[model samples]
Target: MQKHIFNIHDVVLFMTVAECFLLVIFQAILPVKNQLANRLLSTFLISIAITSACILVLWNDDVSLFTAFDEYLLPYFLVIAQMLKGPLLLIYVIALTEDAFKLARRHLVHLIPAAVAVAWLALFQIDSTDLRFRTLGMTETERQIANGVWHFIKIMPFFYALAAVNRVRLYRIGLHNQYSNFSPTEPSWLNILTLGFLFTWSFSILVHVIANTVALAAPQISDLFGIAENYIIFILINALFVNSVVHTHKLLTTKPEAAKDKVDEKLTDTAIQKVQQGMEIQKLFLKQNLNIDEFSKRINLPVKEVSAVINKHYGTNFFEFMNSYRVEEAKRLLSDNQHADMTVMDVLLHAGFNSKSAFHRFFNRLVGMSPTEYRKQNMNKEVKIA
Candidate 1:
């Protein structure tokens, strides 16, 4: 029997795998309201862990352990697991960002490649243990096939990562269109995580390409390339694990009620009236990037009391309430012949909207037309009057 050799790479690989496993368990046990999203993330973590474990196993030079394990599980299983990472990540990001996300039958399409790979492996190799063992000893053709599959797996994630980043970007745009102040609604941690994942994936692909090219040109440096790749992967895994823990803790511990409670509860009708008066008299909505906290401070009211009064009297949240004023002001400006020379962008800026999209979104929702359309119609009316 051949003895297994233990090394630093094994330690790092196992440690990273353990971290991913713990994250999966944490997601399972975490008392989040969005169970589906949590489950999707847990599955993603599982894929990552499996992929990491497979890499460790493939790199292992322990003949006895490799022979024992490789018999039952073909290396093609690793390819399948890797194929899962891109789709699972895309699904997880969609689940996180889309409030209305539901797992539809169409989502199954993403798994087709993995399914095909599994079927191919089962039929050609795993169905017979001897064939699987022989495949592990890989002929030139078999090695080429395996490398082609790996190349596909490595390149596949680039597109999915791009999709995830775009999804997050669109989600932010949606938030900004709907809310005047989007800080409270922003998924900062998720955005950071997605960007980090894209960076890590891009770097990994670059390293893989470089390593493959170097290995072909000078076979002697192949071992060094492998070692460097392992180190880079280890560092990336550790960084991801650390980020997940910190962000997960924040997600779990953060309470919406705590934010609401920042407003004082003792605020009376008189104080609410004062807040309204202050808004009208001071035209606080005209201030760019005005938030509830700032408004509360200006009104000398507790944030909770201000929020409660606004909710009760205005029948809307702080953002909508403020945007209603901005929308009304925009309409007034559009209607005034004195401002006819002002461009739509100038009007939007004067109305406290930083972006044309936000201006159009609110204007359309309130006035039943886009800012440009509203301006054109109003200008046409003035021309008819003249």
Candidate 2:
């Protein structure tokens, strides 16, 4: 074994391991809407910490703990972490996004891959001459098999990252559907984590593929690439921690989705008219920081009936329904030179929007132009006098 010397790379990786452990502890103590999801994420972080720690141990031959564990034991055990990560990542996203997601006994089917990995590791360990760790001792055929198996093992995380991105997409769509005027921080961590997974894992897949190819004796090169991966993973874990600690009071929760079935017959057209008339007469949508419940109470109606009218008749959720009115208000403000001195920020605030991003997003989506562009173009419009 070529014993590795400690360097800044080792220091960075040690910090990664330390970060993972501390994050795990923080998650355990933190309160979340879904404890199962928190625990799953913590477990995933633990696997990374263990995997990184094992690599650190392997790099520094000074660590005699490997000698105690029959040299190849810890290395082979790493396969379980590799296999479990894909399943864990997917489940964690599901738990966070799905309000009704219950971790039942049957969900344990995800463990099958890890169990198989353990059995595979046992197969190699039963033979004292482990072909996996001792590549030079293996025949050409054995090396080919080892490399093929390594490629298969590396694909698991890639698959999970894809699944998580899809789940987060649905969750984002639901968020936009339900709420009005979200701050940047709302669901930003989830977005950061999902996109970060895709960004970080692409390097991992490429590194493993290149490392295991027999034509390219690139294990040493692979180790170099892994340092970059560790840095990104370190950033991602820290981002999670920062968001969790800061947003602990306002923990994210999923609202139950409206059923696609027919609207209740009891919610009469008269009730719908009252909701609409009250909204327009009072301009209730212009109320700052207004929510559906407040909107309902202002109109002197049940919240369910108010939500049903917006969802079923207007063909939008409470958020979009409110923004539609706000967009119209913004357009009216922008069209007239009377408010020409008003900035886009001023218009957004007067139109009942708290988030500039949400203001721009809705205005652009509905009007097909930026708020500033719309303002500049229309401010010069002249009224026709016949």
Best by TM-score: 2
Which residue pairs show backbone clashes in model 2? Answer: none
Task: Compute each candidate's TM-score over C-alphas.
Answer: 0.58, 0.74
Which TM-score value belongs to model 1? 0.58
In order, the Cα lDDT scores of the candidates are: 0.68, 0.73
Model 2: lDDT to the true structure: 0.73
lDDT of 2 by residue, 322-373 (tens): 8899999999999887898898899999999988888999999999999988
lDDT string for model 1 (150-266, tens) is 567777777787788877776664443333454432367667767767776776676667756786687556655556555665575555555554554333111123344524445
Q: Which ten residues in a row have the lowest lDDT in candidate 2?
A: 124-133
Q: Report the Cα RMSD per candidate.
A: 13.7, 5.0
lDDT of 1 at 86: 81
After superposition, which runs of candidate 2 have C-alpha atoms over 4 Å from their true positions? 1-5, 28-37, 66-72, 124-137, 214-220, 247-251, 256-318, 330-351, 360-386
